[model samples]
Target: MLQLEIVTPEKKIYSGPVHDVYLPGSEGEMGVLEMHAALVTSLVPGELRYTVDGKTEALAVGTGFAEVTQERVLVLTDMAAGEAEIDEAATEAAIERAQQQLDQLDHDHDLEEVAMLEAALAKSFAQLKLKGKYKGLQ
Candidate 1:
């Protein structure tokens, strides 16, 4: 088994031994199993899946960084939520709000602010997509 931990600034979301882990890396999606190579990589807003005890689980994660080693995987992200935890209505609302904010931006708007909003929009969309996939299973 490989130890896995997912953490955000507010709290530690998950910590346990997992059979495998899949992340949305900035470059692409990657999967990790026991004795995987040691490396650190940036993660994007997308679905994160893992297997434990022969069962698969998933989460929608915001942008962050992950550290992988032979024995452990540590993820530090801005946000992480299980399918059941995501509120589709709220997510849709957030997406609309972000889009509105982006539309309202002018030439003089702070570039950093625009980037942040874009990231937020992307994250919300990822959450919605993940939530939708498992909605019927719930």
Candidate 2:
């Protein structure tokens, strides 16, 4: 078993043993299992999945970094939420708001603001995708 711990700025969402773990690496998706190599990598907004007790669970996570060791995996992210924690309507509204903000930016705009808005839009989209996937399971 591999000890997996996911923490956000607000709290620690999960800390337990898992059979396998998958993360959205900055370049692409990657999987980690017990005895895997030790490393650290940046994570993008996407779905993070893990298998525990023969059941696979998932969470939508925002920008962060992950530290993987032979026996433990630590995920430090800006945001992490399960399907039940994501509100579809609210996520949709957030996406719209972000889009509006991005659209308002003209030829000369603050790069940081644009990046922040894009990040927010991407995170909101990830949440919506996770919610949709869980709904399909119902």
Candidate 3:
């Protein structure tokens, strides 16, 4: 087993031992096991999954960084939500709002704002996916 800790700005979502962890790496998905190599990687807004005693748990996470070591994995993200914590209607509304803002944006819009909206869309979509709640809403 490997120690896994997931933290967001607001709280520590999880802290315990897990059989394995799958991170949404910038390059791609990465799985870390016990005795894994030590490294750091960037994460995107996506789903993160881990197995604990044969049961798998998943969370929707925002952009962050992960630190892996021989015995532990630590993830620090801006946002993290589990299926039970996600509100489908609210998430959909957020997606709609972000998309509307993105659509209204022009070439001269602030690049930072555009990126933030895009990240919001991605994070909301990821939450929907965690709950299997997407119904052609995007």
User: Where in model 1 is the C-alpha error above 4 Å?
Assistant: 107-109
Per-candidate alpha-carbon RMSD to the true structure = 1.0, 0.9, 3.4
Candidates' TM-scores? 0.96, 0.97, 0.93
Write one digit per residue (lDDT tens) for candidate 1, span 1-138: 999999999999999999999999999999999999999999999999999889999999999999999999999999999999999999999999988888888736578889999999989989999998998995
Error of 2 at 43 (Å): 0.3
The local lDDT score (0 to 100) that residue 17 gets in candidate 2 is 99
Which model, 2 or 3, shows the larger TM-score?
A: 2
Which residue pairs in candidate 1 collide?
none
Alpha-carbon lDDT, every model: 0.94, 0.95, 0.92
Q: Which residue runs of candidate 2 sit more than 4 Å off their true CA positions?
A: none
Q: Candidate 1, which ten residues in sequence have the lowest lDDT sum?
A: 101-110
Displacement of the residue 73 alpha carbon in candidate 3, Å = 0.2
Q: Tell me how candidate 3 scores on lDDT.
A: 0.92
Q: What is the clash count for each candidate, in the order shown? A: 0, 0, 0
Whichever of 2 and 3 has more lDDT, that candidate is 2
Identify the leading candidate in terms of TM-score.
2
Measured with C-alpha atoms, the lDDT of residue 132 in candidate 1 is 87
- Per-residue lDDT tens digits for candidate 3, residues 1-138, read 999999998989999999999999999999999999999999998999999999888899999999999999999999999888899999999999998888888847578899888889989988988878433433
Please state the error at residue 36 of candidate 1 in Å: 0.8
